[model samples]
Target chain A: MNEGTTVLITGATGFIGGRLVEMLAGRARVRALVSAYTRTSRIARYPVEMVRGDIRDEAAVAQAARGVDVIFHCAYGSRGTPEEKRAITVGGTKNVIAAARASGARLVHLSTQMVYGTPEKGVITEELPRQEGGGTYAESKVEAENLVEAAAAAGLPATILQPTAVYGPWAPVWTVGVLARMREGKVPLVNGGEGACNAVYIDDVIQAMLLAARREGALGERFLVSAREPVSWRDFYGSYEEMLGFPATVPVRVEEAVEPQRRGRRWALPQLLELAREEPSVRSRLGNTFEGQLARRLAGPLFRRRSTPSRTPELDKLRRLRSKPELPVYRLSPTDASFYASTARVEIGKAQRLLGYEPGYDLRAGMELTGEWARWARLVPAKAEEQQAQQKRKGVEAQ
Target chain B: MMVGAGRAAESLHLPAAAMTAQVTTSVIADRNLERAREVARNYGVEQAVAGAEEGKAFADAAILALPHHLHARVARELLEAGLHVLVEKPLALTAAECAELGTIASERRLVLEVGMVRRRFPALRFVKRALERELLGGIRRVTLEEGMPFAWEVTSDFTFRRETGGGVLADSGIHVLDLLAWWFGELEPVAYSDDDMGGVEAEVQFTLRLPSGAPVEVELSRTRELRNSIIIEGERGSLEAGLAFGGALRLDIGEAPLLIGQAQPHASEAGGDYQNVRELFIEQLENFRDSIRGTSSPLVDASEAMVAVGLLERLRAMREPLELPWVTANTTRAA
Candidate 1:
């Protein structure tokens, strides 16, 4: 399918799908199927047709899928309750695939490496069996991919692209979130930041997804599209501090990373105990108010106005050992810490040889490009290119 | 164009060259020749040298993104070779070292900028301009606080060394300290104590007297998160300069009680990147480039960073050291 073909992008207002619409606008007849929740869309600027519909709604997916030669299914829930996740992932995929089948359109399904269940093996290839337990996001994605594989086996022209930790200009968790946190002088590095962050640049993933549409060898195949080399979360993410223009500090060992089991007991047990100690409704309200006032009175000393030498004598200061008046450091949910620890590197030779995919952007280049967009958007403050141009002009004057 | 092709140079500072007009990396030198070559390749730099000596002719000026202890040594070499230089913070470990470097820059007529990134924040810049504009009265009480848990991935070992001016104080504290000096002129350290933990302090608390007799209380940490803000009480009223970088200079101004202060969050906006460090860093570079072009002196000079280092040196000297449990984990990445 080329310029004459009709293409429908399910999550056209999203980061990846929006980018795809931009790339494919002139190449084909592009129609964007954006959900009502698409707050802001760059695709709205393009000449493509807009179809407002939730992917989970069968009639909406079917109506939008009508007359399209290629359906690039990319929408999924990033946030919601558990039932909503399943509806967006498994239920939504089922509706999209059925529409694609009904329309005889080629389905280019966007899946995630999360299906592999945070591999224990260092280098995962596509041949490995799909592990079952990676929470709702992974499990739901796996269920969707399973439906895709089944549809392909039943003779629907379909392809699946499993993109790894996709990060770019607008990728919330990776680029924006990371840069945002770096500004605050904190990045929660799990397991001393030694875990693999199999980060793939968005451009690379886009290229692979595009190639999946046209490549003859991609029929009925699942491809893992990622950077050739996996970066250690430290070397990969630790560099964010230096890149974002802060002096690098020794990463503090997160208790959640090093001692996750005990952290649960330390955190949840007290809350559970407090909840278990039931009182009459009126007494509970009064006790809560009293407790809050008492705690405030106790913490009053910490906020006291001080303009003198520390009262504690030198060497006898053990009494105030852990007493500090500052902000609480970066705290991650135990689940998040575990996710950081379990991130795995994988081989992408299948994408290279089969789909003719080349992982063009390394971690540095990817981050640099993201920084460029961030600079354009005024997220990051430093500008090296401007400085370079000034230097060139100065050299011309000197010569 | 840059020395020390380590993590900082590779990430924030290196990319910053691309963002600024007159600044770009022509060559990068690192201890590891391959690493230098790799950085040069990644950033599209033309030449990758093995050491500082080999990169002398590549660019008009150089940014010293090296570690804290190595600033003066590397800066001196670059300065003597007739290269304009920008040194990263804790400009040098000592005032005398910074002075020596400053003398050379003066003799050579080369611009020597210091990498005090936070000063470039819109909020802090606004705060300084407000003080200079005399819209606010004489300083009364200053509270400089930043608390966030220690959660960065540290790769290099030298950052943990005491001689190198390592730990949270030098790494994160210097920015707040330099900002304090920038706003209030100078600070006389009345009291300083830190959770030394043997190698370096993870947390520090200080009582400083500003020139206007304002007691500037500072708290910095890599252990806990604190309200990352600056509160100033003047003769007329008080203003809180909150959200230092990549966000608004959230200010609240009122008479006696700040609780009754007017919340002027969107009072001033439109920084390069109000919420990102890169924009402030770019602003700093832009100022440095302008200084190089004879527009004006940089917003922060070598002296500003030197004052911060001097304070750090004094704090370290007066420190009541406490030992933290010595434990090391082999956290090398699995193959």
Candidate 2:
């Protein structure tokens, strides 16, 4: 990638691809292939050529890849059903591979470390075989990697980069998502969050992608890109707690599914009340009706019975319902428990040696920067008192 | 007459106009004649045309729901043709353009209202009355946050482009800024920052000084779900109101929080009950009709709406890139 090199980036509206466009817009002639559904506010600021198209459109992908020297195939379906994910991850990769092959453009595919799945205990590296049944997202990535590898064997210039838990500003999963859960006090820690986290800063991953795009030796190679050392899951989320100025997450144990015991007829009204509380749409719909309004107006006085010496079970249920509903606790699923309990440490020595890639931001530095964004994004408050003091100082200076 | 049959005209203005007995929507116009015809058929309008010029003969008042960039030119045309115009929010892209429209409307003595429908919200009216009555004594600080995932059914890509007056600040910030100006008389821009590199911003944070020198912090976004509420802290107490058109207004003084106002049903002129957002739009339409009929003044006339436009213009002039510390020095140096 040089000053005059023309590159087409798929998923240019996404986090990684958007950042890539920002970094490359000034140095290279950047072209972005964006989907109509995705908002382009993040990347439309740059002087990059935007081509509206989805990766599944072969003609559109080829059109965007035309006259370009490099193709950054970063688009993947993160949402939707399994079939939709497969269509985008596997089928879309097929189209990208075809386009890359036809245009003779160097392809750099973004894969995930989840291809290795929840390995029991080992130093995970690029040489390890990708597991088969690692759920929809991981399986899709594995299948996509297979396509890229097949294309590489057929003499198409391609490089695969598997990043582990990429987290930084604008990161949906590890940064914003974690902060939201932590703020709600719903962050569930499986077995006290003792799992090893191969957390990598987003900029470092972009650096690896750039190196892979430019380095001749990176072709026909797959690299596991991550920070130098792994951090514990507790430490990973703990950094966010420190930024938030309070501890909010709770620890929960992993257990098998349990069936609810049947209750007598007295529990029916309480169950209905719980359901109404859980679903606002249903509650609102019922509340808007004439009967519901009349019932609501009368139910309060009807259920206001004082505790008597011979209280009935129905009265006790009504009294309990009158009290505040308990907040539901977050519990990790079996798969999530297994994922958060993994002890495997991902190694990035291959990327370091082969592509001259070095992690620019360590865990502490990355979290510090992330904290700045979190405050700026208002994910965590920049404390009202502090902001007022700063404003007052600025106001005085202006005066 | 309705110019530009886009999402707002289809869902909001048309439905509200149908409910207002004094207002009759006679014509629907758009550059794309098919869209105009479809909307006209759905709304049961008498005629569809390719441009406002063709539709002007059928109606006395026109609702200009065109894109933001076209508001000034189209409204000027309609006002010059001796028609009352109700343009959508922000009036125009710049404060000067908004002022120019106001000048034309005043010169012709036509009703030129801006569709800042949030001004008609019951909760907002309650908050304004509370402030006027000094219920929350001596306002100290104010913070307003409004955000939601970008899910609007836009007819074109203009909403995401800067040249078309797109961005969260222009689209959503206009409503909030107008509310602030309505509450606390003139706003002076303090500082402005946004997550924009060279394109439109999805998220922005800025500060303004009210007439009393109190700092007003605003954060608007089209990318995430925020608290979506406005909090005004005062020396005596505080008030929190929903940023949405149908949000509740709450007063918090130290004891249990009291809900001052929720979605209360109000009787319309036609003797029908309307509530929440539906009532908001209906009130705005009725106000526009009454302004045209010389029975009442516009809630948000062109000149009054320009206050927000001026503040936005100044904020954009002093805009700084929001600090993105996660961007490595290497990337910055490369750029």
Candidate 1 structure quality by residue, lDDT tens digits, B147-201: 6644444334345446666667788788877887777787888888775533455
Residue A254 displacement in candidate 2 (angstroms): 8.0
Return the top candidate by lDDT: 2
DockQ of each: 0.01, 0.23
Which lDDT tens digits does candidate 2 get at residues B1-335?
98999888898889989988878898999999999999999999989999999999998899998878888999998899999999998799888998888999999899999988777666676678778889888877888889887887766667777777878888889988899999888789999999776667888999998778888999888776789999998867789888775677778876666657653432232233445576667878888888988999998888899989998899999998876655435664213
Lowest-scoring 10 consecutive residues by lDDT in candidate 1 chain B?
B326-335
User: After superposing the true interface residues, what Cα RMSD does each candidate give?
Assistant: 23.8, 3.9
- TM-score for each candidate, following the candidate numbering: 0.47, 0.81
Off by over 4 Å in 1: A37-40, A247-328, A333-335, A384-399, B1-335
- CA lDDT scores, all candidates in order: 0.71, 0.80
